[model samples]
Target: MTIRAAHFTPEVLLEAPRRSEATPNSKGSLALFSVSTYSFSEHKRQSELRVLDISRNESKLVTDSEDASNPKFLDDNLITVLESKDGATNVLIGDVNDFKKTNYTAGTIDGSVDDWKIKDVGKGKYLIAIAASTQPDGTLYNSEKAKKPVTTGRIYNSTFVRHWDTWVTANKNSIWVGTLSKDSKTSKFALGHFENKLKDSGLESPIPPFGGAGDFDITDTNLAFVAKDPKLNPAFNTKQNLYVIKLDNGSSPKKIDIPGFEGATSNPNFSPDGKKLAFLSMVQNGYEADKNQIFLLDVEQSDPPKGLFTTPDNKGTWDRSPSSITWSNDQKNLYVTAEENARVKLFSIPLAANSTNSSFPKAVFDEGSVASTTFLDSGLFISSSSLIDNSAYHLVPSSGAPKLLSSSSRSGSSFGLSRSQVSEIHFPGAKPGTTIQAWLIKPSFFDDSKKYPLAYLVHGGPQGAWEDSWSTRWNPAVFAEQGYVVVTPNPTGSTGFGQELTDAIGGEWGGLPYQDLVNGFDYVEKNLSYVDTDRAVALGASYGGYMMNWIQGNDLGRKFKALVTHDGVFSIPGQLGTEEIYFPNREFGGPFWENKDAWNKWDPAQKTENWATPHLIIHSEKDFRLTIAEGLAAFNVLQEKGVESQFLTFPDENHWVLKPENSLLWHTVVLDFINRKVGLKAYSEQSETAKALKESALSG
Candidate 1:
């Protein structure tokens, strides 16, 4: 059979619009968002600040800066913008009238700003909480310095000499308070003494490699931030405790003592009255992915923070982790966006006395995943997106339904490429009485009369779910555009389901979760007449990559014509030795020496003897989570077995292919490998546009 190649091009796949930093004003009448436009030819990203009127459902340009972010409403008449250009970052305050008029010029705050918050400290004085990175001696760490070493020679004293994508530096993040004068004649802003030193004598806040603005909260008199105690080993310990730094006396930050939450605490949000602090805490230490429980700290009380759900009098329960929390106007309720099943929904928890409702976190909105929520007098303004849509602002009234307030240029209606039609499929679970949900995305130009191949995409985290949300990487639409049906399933271990479901795969990585995937495929093949089962391909990254490797070594190898694994785990033991050891130990039930059999049972390297599927391996040299060695070992095994296989490595990339040029190449290579393996014409022969894009990406 002479198979024809698909007509989709790399440019079409790489040109999707990006949106981030969606923030709503205090009144909730206005919302600001950053929209990024990527140019593959130029290999650069240009971002603009756009403000939306929630009441009018209209949006207007706010800034012309290509790198504007963290747009926050400082007051009714002013907003703050974090502008980054030429390696320098600064905070700019823009007039609301000027922003509405599309005038980009604004007053600048002299400093490299990472995060900032404005609080009225009384008597015409304003306190600004600024989180910026600086050298040990209180000097700004510029981009040039970050690119070059502090010293001409290389020296290391700590284990984190390098992290996920960047080398470690002595420059540490700290909270600095600045005073803003209210008098119009002398309107001045001056940086004051550092309120909290994130890194002091080898101690740091928010923890390295991940934490940021979400790790801290500010009040008129006090500031609370998350940090690991210096006494503990920074390399292995993940316990992050909340510490409060008093602004009045500038005392040393004191760690709040939480009885059972030894794991990690983050996202500190202070109530309107400033008497209570709400944060997210994990019960088990070292297990980063452990369920995050909401905790409330009464500042007046000296005792530890109380777990909202684990209180002795109230057995309040929430199955999912709460994120991006905000206090209600009256400070009687806390609103948060949390994952439930395949969608991230808004949930509210009441913080009133004598409220014993266990199911207090009532769902406020149901459609699409809410990334963030801001409460205003009018209603709740949200930045939301789904599998078929990009992020946009939506305002949900307290008494009425949600209304679209802002429109994204990259929405399904405006997307240049053929958009995919997404639908959820439910099938009997691999376990008793359990139901699994899988998303089926069909090409917009789908013709049921002609069969189409299936691109079965698996998610990472093993604990992570393939949520109904937009993704720049491993997008289902990219596959659908190639005339293939994309199937994304939430197996046994996937989150957003429940703690029971999420914890099930901890020690049984390849057990029920693998079966759930297999069952999902079986259900689709039996029910969907348009699916070309014979031409199917399986692909995944990280934990999903581990599953891809597992598939090749099991009976499932015969089901798919080809397989692709990116940064997958080839050997559990190897990963334990190379990657972060604590997580592996916790997830796999102890160290390799103690649980040799448990580690060996699911080791993909051990089952290589049964492998026969054609494989494509993709890995990055800097992928610390799953080292490049895992990919190399899998590719080596494939070659030794005389299997048709290819390997692609990215030297500058980390666990995920993030660079625009590299991401374009990744899509091209993976698509080309699948085409060639499925008996279709090669990607080079399919479209000249694809060939040119690939060549340009490779050469540049």
Candidate 2:
């Protein structure tokens, strides 16, 4: 007898293995990566470090410890990784071949380490650069500060009183460079002393919240980093400048000047010879979604170190914004990844002098979305994923086609997923000349003869798009497997199509983008016969959440059976509650005081009379970006309007629900909400435990 596998569910999506980007050796013959999986049965997560042999396309386990992370290649045979020791981050050095047998603790620092980089200068001498939080007194900052100076109130005179999820404090993230003297007798390394790179500058390198080692680069003689301009107010400014300092001399940091470019800088990379630097920059001062242009700097070794900054001559012709930048091993070309249409593709830009204005970036790899790339002597090492696939690795050689190195799930049997169930489509946009792209997903056991409810998902960022990518949160697959024909539409403000489309939503937030969503819904109703529009539901987060509120007030609100919004805006004037004040300013053309009509034109709070749809509102208390008040206001309105509504709050989470247990509960509640409203219960085959929870949710 043959027993079929269970359909794809929230459990399958969350428990599947998550793989990190692969780090290649100097020769590019071997790569190191990690895989982590959560076990519901054990209520824990297990991680393993693996080494991949490129020649044979095989991988072997190196370690399975959960403590190890941020692995980097020190040499062809050596590696350095971060591990937790005595409640502090410690560096461990070991051979890649036999890590357990030859590993030893290299050094431990005082504070929490977010990222670290190591360079072997020569002959028993090395430099270790650690990116950690540093206090004004030059000591590393850690969790100890949480318990000391127990002040019940926090005082602030600046606009950035809070950001993202943390309260603004005196501590800033800076790079600490220290010398590691190797003991020749025992072959062990000891850390001597440390120096704060941005001591008194009142600046931070590797900007707060999400910056890491990529924000700075180090070579044998000099260090280059990007820091937010200290003069600008962080709450309303999006400017990050570049600086270089001499490692051998006690010289002050020199700001690298890019005359016309003044927006933001990221991913500083030094050439192999350490004579030139390459990075990505944006041109606008306040816009965070500006095009990322590639820039280069040439350094002359002289007193005060003369530096020349220049952008690519073809920058004016390159329409796509590069998300990441990397120099080829030979320094003749640069590799970058950018979103085109609806896919993130890797392209090669030649640096030859003969390159003409017609020289556009040539796409080398366009299979799935390229998450990250590691430039290698052979070619490029890529980590990518798609709507059905979770993780895959490929090597695009210098001359030949790309070769598949490894895949997280090679077959649908692994998690009951199939590429056939995923598809893409295009339809007429809100305007005549524009077109909208959407990804349509069907259930694993889809029956075309049966009608399925429509799951309409709007993406955040307004500048963001729904790509041919896989995600654990708000996964279209999870919705599809539960008897829905999920449709994710990229409307007017969605990126990847071009800059024009992405910029169209500014100041017209609730105008054209909302029309595009209505057009998309209408298209599905008339075109996709398998979808039951009468049983449709809409959901989104951030800008998408804002759209849900917008839809609730507009004529589109009557078409949906239910709506789910996470961390969304309730009123346009409510922008004052956001931490990134500049975001609303750039989008609406100015602050509410300066642009009264524009701010109130699309206010959802003013259109509360039409709010009759059932809504599920989810918001985190720590999400300073949108703040908890926005969610509370929306829920209050829904309740006062006599609408079916439920508010779910996570005090420990931020804008996103990242904790494993919380994510499970989130998915369970969300699925139950939509399913009950759509006149279906998709989890009938679940165990008694899940049924009890679903019943409890219904009762509540």
Candidate 3:
């Protein structure tokens, strides 16, 4: 069976530019943002800087290059941006008036800068904090030479052999401070010799692979950054601690001794007065996603840091995880963004006299999911969006409705669907008095009397929720474009509902969450006449993938015509050894040996005899979180049981398909598999390009 390929073409759904990394100037009159444009034909990403005038609501292009990001306002007239050129990344300082550019890392070899801070001191002296990657000897690690070993067949002496998506290299991130000196000839500023702050202690700033500007902060006399010691167990002991280095007098960095909270500390921010430091701390060791609370430390006093406002229960739960903290000019209030009831809202908390006990976070912006926010003299400038809307900038006042400043219309319009097409649906769960929220996205060309095929997508994080936020991956609009009525539900294990609902799936991954999904499907089928339940397909990744595996083994296998599992766990006991050991152990109650019954209760490997559903198994080799072994085992079971299935593997990808070309291939394969299994052949014709792609996929 074949369908017209025009509806599923990449050009129809892939032309949106991504906007991020918004930074407002001191006066808040103008803001700079990075906009990324993708070219599917070329398979490349090009980034450009857009300067938005807050008052006028106008944007002007600043720089257009492949490596332009992290734009910061050094001063009212000076702007700094990171640019990559000739296979090296460097800091570029530009004047706002004339846009004259100057390369700060001119003499440095193959240098790269990640996060940097510029602070003005007295008498033309400036303290600059830079999170830069260089070799152990303060030189650039030549990529061409690093690819080849210095000595053939050298002995290995590294702890982290590889991480996330890249192999661990000798290039490590270090914090450096450089003084600005004006060149007499050109009247442009250049950094005078940079001093390595982390020279005495061999540690990397922002830890590696994941940390960013949130992991560090800077003041006039001191710089506080997050780093993990390589000597510790790299696998299970990835705890980042806060270390403060004095800018002057050459003092070694000192680890801040915060009593009772010794796990991971990040998002360091200094108060306006610089007397106190505010940061986020997680209490449990080895568990990265443990509940994080805001902590305040008095720089002058040696007392332990005070635990400020936390969730209502005061326990390390999943209720609140505050991030993107910003301090008010008066130092009396701190603003943060946290997940609440299926959306991320901006919240503000007052700092009391004692600093120990503070008021609960008051919701500042409650409408949409805020991704990034910046403070201005007029109001708060935020980038927010709903499930049906694309990311846009809004100016939110102290007490008024948020005004839209700029919208990402390029991608939003590319979907060819209006906001009215997507609506929220709530249904009662299997458990009494419990309500499950699901988003129903109707196809653009919909009729009330017509029945449409259903696409049920499950979100990954057992603690994750299908919030009213836009997603580039697993987009409901894409599924809707393929003539499927998409339904995404936030079940019992999902966050953003409440602590009780999220905690209900801690030890019962296959229990309440599974029932909530089934009940959700049943509700849609029974109540919604437009949904064709008999022609439904279920797809999921991570925990959702685990549920797919569970459903295939359980009685729910007969409900859906086909299933798609991406990087899902098949055997709990087998995954216990290969997967990341910390969170799974806690979520499954205990070790597999100690809690064998709990581990095997929902183990899909134990019920392979009941697996009859046709499935599409997807896995990546670098997915260290779930590992490729899980996908292989599930595929092996399906083959042995003679159930129709196909296995797709990406040798270069990680837990998520990130590369542009890889993502295109993933979507193509997934859509083709679903269409073939669900017998979707309305057009009964195929384009030559579509046939060529199908043949290529099969031949490869």
Instruction: Name the regions of candidate 2 deviating beyond 4 angstroms.
Output: 1-5, 56-58, 144-147, 301-315, 353-358, 411-413, 682-700
Q: Tell how far residue 451 is off in model 3, in angstroms.
A: 2.0
For candidate 1, write residues 89-147 as lDDT tens digits.
55566675575453243334434667777777776566777777777776556665455
Model 3 misplacement above 4 A = 1-10, 97-110, 122-124, 134-147, 150-161, 169-171, 183-186, 200-202, 229-232, 310-318, 353-358, 410-414, 428-434, 576-579, 679-691
Candidate 2's TM-score = 0.94
1-700 per-residue lDDT for model 2 (tens digits): 0122476788777888888878889898899999888876777998989888878878888777788888888779787778865547777888899998888888777777888777778897878788988877867886754447766687887778888999988888999888877798987777768788778877798898888888998888888899999999989999999888888887767887776677888888887778878788877888888877776677654322121222444234567777887778787877889999888999887776533222468999998799988888777989998888888889998898899887776634566788899888788888679999999999988998889999999999979998877788878888998889999999998888888888889988899899999999999999989889999999999999999999999899999999999999899888898888999999988878989898888888888899999999999999999988999999999998889999888889999998776777788778878898898784533534345545554534
TM-score of each: 0.91, 0.94, 0.90
Local distance difference test, candidate 1: 0.76
**lDDT (Cα, tens digit) per residue for candidate 3, span 301-354:** 777777775444456433687766888777888888887777889988887776
Say which candidate scores most in lDDT.
2
Residue 258, candidate 1: alpha-carbon lDDT: 75
> Between candidates 2 and 3, which one is better according to lDDT?
2
Backbone clash pairs for candidate 3 read none
lDDT of 1 at 396: 79
Worst 10 residues of 2 by lDDT: 302-311
Clashes of each: 0, 0, 0
